[model samples]
Target: MSFRALLWALGLLVAALFAASLLIGPAGLSPSDSLAALIAGRGEAAALVMREIRLPRAILGALVGASLGLSGAALQGYLRNPLAEPGLIGVSSSAALGAVIALQTGLAGAFALALPLMALAGALIAVLILLGLAGPRGGALTLILAGIALSALAGALTSLVLNLSPNPYAAAEIVFWMMGSLTDRSFTHVWLALPLTLIGWALILPLVRGLDALTLGEDAAAALGVRLARLRVTLVVGVAACVGAGVAVAGAIGFVGLIVPHLLRPLVGARPGRLLPASALGGAALLLAADIAVRLIVPERDLKLGVLTAIVGAPLFLHLIYKTRAAQ
Candidate 1:
C-alpha cells in the first residue's frame, strides 16, 4: 500500500477505536446512548461517563503514546541502535521514581507541579549519568551497559521508597501506579501534561533531519553541517520532557516507545526522518486499541496498561534480540 493509503487507514482505525473506547467501558454504554448524550447534552450519567471518565483517558492515551513513540524514534536514530528505548535506558524508570517521591512526600498532593517537575528532574539525571558513563567515543555496547546500570539503581531506589512508606494506602497507590493504568483518570491529568508533551514534540520534530544525518555516523553528520553537540542536548531535553510528563501521569508504561517505532520503521521505508511522525500516529493507534481491549477483556478488574503492552511487546523484543544476534 502507498504511504498515504496506510496513513488514512491508520487514521480511520484510530477513530474507530476511540469511538469504541467511549462506548465500551465498565458502564457499557451503547453507541446510541453515547451519541444521544453527546448530542442532547442530557443524561447526566452518560455525560459523566463520556466527559468525566473515558474522554480524558483516551486523550491521555494518545498523548502518552505519541510522546513515547517520538522519543523512541529519536533515541534509536541518535544512538544508531535500533534496540534503544526510553524504558531500556532507565529514563522512564527514573521519571517514575521522581513522581513517586513527589507523591510520597505529600508535595504533589499540595500542588499540581510537583510530580511533573520531579519526573523531569529524574529523567535529566538519568541522561546525565548515562552520558558520563558512556563518554564521547563510547559505542553502542557501552551505552547499553550504562543504561542497564542506571536502570538497576533507579529500580532499587523505587523499591526501597515503597517499602519504607508510612502510609499503607500511599504504598499501595505507588505499587498500582508503577504497574501503570489509565483507569479512572481525570481531566486534571490531561491539562497538566499536554503543554509539556507539545513542547517536547516541537523540539524533536526539527531534529528529524539531524537524526537522518547522524544515522550516517557522528562524523558524517558533523561533516554534513549537523552540530553534533547541540543536537545531542536538544534530543536529550526533548526525550526527558516527553517521557517525564508521560511517566508522571501514567507511571512508566513500557514498550509503546520500543515497539511502535520498530513496527512502523518499515512502513516509513526505514528512514528515521519519515519514521518519526509515522510512529507517533501508529503509537497513538496501538495504545488506544490496547486501552479498549483492557476495558472489554475484564470490566471488573483493573487491567494495567503496562501489563497489556508487556504481554505484546516482550515476544517482539525477544525476536528482535535473536535477529540482531543472528545477523552479528
Candidate 2:
C-alpha cells in the first residue's frame, strides 16, 4: 500500500480499537452511553466509569503504545539493528527497577506521583550510563552487549528488592506491579504520562530525517549533514522519557515496542521516518486490542498485559533471531 493508504488504515484501526476499548468493559455500558459519558459526562455511573476508569486506561494505552512504537523504530533506525527496543535493551527493566525501589521503600505509597518520577529517573540513568559505556557512535554489537549487561544487573537488583522485602505483602505487591496493567488507572496517570510522552514524541519526530539518512550508514549520513551527536542525544532522551513514563504508569508492558515496528515496517517501507508514525499508530492499535482482550479474556482474573504480550512476543522474537541467523 501507499504511505497515505497505510496511514489511513492505521488511523482507522486505531480509531476502531479505541472505540472498542471504550465500549467493551466490565461496566457494559452501551456504545452510545460510553461515547456520551466520555464526551459530555451525561450519565453519572457511566460518566464515572468512562471518565475515571476507562478514559484514562484507553488514553494511556494509546499514549504508551505510540511511545513504545516510535522509540522502537528510532532505536532500530539509529542502531541499524532490528532487535533494538526498550525492553530488549534494558531501559524498561532499569526503569522498572527504579519503580520497584520506590514501592519497596514505600515512597510510592507516601507520594502519588513518586512512582513514575522514580521510574523516569531510572531510565534516564540507564540511558546516560549505556551511552557512556558504548560511546555515542557505538556499533550494534557494542550496544547489544552493553544492553545485555545492564538488563542482567537491573534484573538482579529488582529480584534482590523483591526477595529482601520487609514482608510478604511488599514482595507480592512488587511482583504483581511488575506484571503490568492499565486497570483502575485514572486521569492522574494520564497527567503523569502525557506531557512527558508528548515531549518525547517531539524529540523523536525530528530525528526521522536523520534516521532515514542513517540507513545509508553513519559515515554517509554524516557526510549528508546529519549531526551524529544531536541524533544520539535526541534518541536517548526521547526513548528514556517515553519508556520510563510508560513503565511508571503501566508497570513494564514489554514487547509492544519490539513487536509493533517489526510488524508494520513492510507496510510503511524501509525508511525509518515513514516507519516511525506508522509504527506509532500500529502500536496504539495493538496495545488497545490487547487491553480490550485482557478485559474479555479473563474478566475475573485481571490478566496482566505484560504476560499476554510476552507470550506472543517471545516466540516471535526468537523466530526473528533465527531468521537473522539464517540470513547470515
Candidate 3:
C-alpha cells in the first residue's frame, strides 16, 4: 500500500480503538451514548463514566502506548539493535523499582509526584549506569549484556523491597502493581503523566534526522554532522521521561514498545524517522485493543493488561531470536 493509505489505515484503527475503549467498560453504555457523554456531557451515569473513568483511561492508553512505541523505535534505530526495548534495557524495571520503593516506603502516599519522580530518577540512573558499563561505543553484545545485568539488579532490588515490606497489604499492592493494569485509573494519573510524556516525545522527535544519519554508523553519522553525544543525551533523558512516566501510571506495561515498532518497520520501509509516528499510532491501537481484550476476557477476574501483552510478546520475541540466529 501507499504511504498515504498506510497512515489512513493506522489513523482509522486508532480512532476505532479509542472509541471502543470509551464504550467497552462494564457500564453497559452504547457507543453513541458513550461518545455523547464524552462530547456533550449528557446524562449522569454516562457522564460520570465517560468523564471520570473511561476518558482518562483512553487518553492515557494513547499517551503511554505512543511513548513506549516512540521510545522503542528511537532506541532500536539509534543503537541499531533489533531487540532493544524499554523493558529489555532495564528502563522499565528500574522505573518499577523506584515506584515500588516509593510505595513500600510510603513516599508515594506522602507526595503525589513521588512515584513518577522516583521512577524518572531510576530510569535516569539506569541510563547513566548502562552507558558507563557498556560505554557509548559499545556493540550490541556488550549493550545487551550490560542491560541484562542491570535488569536483573533492578528486579532483585524490587523484589527485596517487596520482601522486606512490613505491611502485607503493601506487599500485595506492590505485587499487583508489578503485574500492571489500567483499571479504575482516574484523571489524576492522566494529568500526572501527560506533561512528562509529551516532553519526552518532543525531545526525541527532533532526533529522527540524527537517528537516520547514525544508520550509516557512528563515524559516518558524525561525518554527516550528527552530534553523537548530544543525541545520546537527548535519547536518554527522553526515554526516561517516556518510560518512567508510563511505568508510574500504568505499572510496567511491556512490549508495546518492543512489538509495535517491529511490526510497523517494514511498512515504513524500515526508515527510522518514518517509523516513529507510525509506531506511535500502531502502539496506541495495539494497546487499546489489548486493554479492551483484557476487560472482556475475564470481566469478573479483571486480567492484568501486562499479562496479556507478555503472553503474546514473549513467543514472538523468541521467534525473532530464532529467526535472527537462523539468519546468522
Give each model's whole-structure lDDT.
Answer: 0.81, 0.84, 0.84
lDDT of each residue in 74-191, candidate 3, tens digit only: 8888777777788777888899898888877899899978888888898889878877776765456677788888888987888888889987765665555555788888999988
User: Superposing every Cα of model 2 onto the true structure, what RMSD results?
Assistant: 2.2
lDDT of 2 by residue, 260-294 (tens): 98898877777889999998898899889899999
lDDT by residue for model 1 over 56-170, one digit each (tens)?
9988888888888888888887777777788877888899889888878888999888888788889889877776776644456777788788778877788778768897766
Give the total clashing residue pairs for model 1: 0
Supply the global lDDT for candidate 1. Answer: 0.81
The positional error of residue 86 in candidate 3, measured at the CA in angstroms, is: 0.3
Model 3, position 92, has a per-residue lDDT of 85
Please identify model 2 stretches exceeding 4 Å from their true place.
Answer: 103-114, 132-142, 162-168
Give the C-alpha miss distance for residue 275 in model 2, angstroms: 0.8
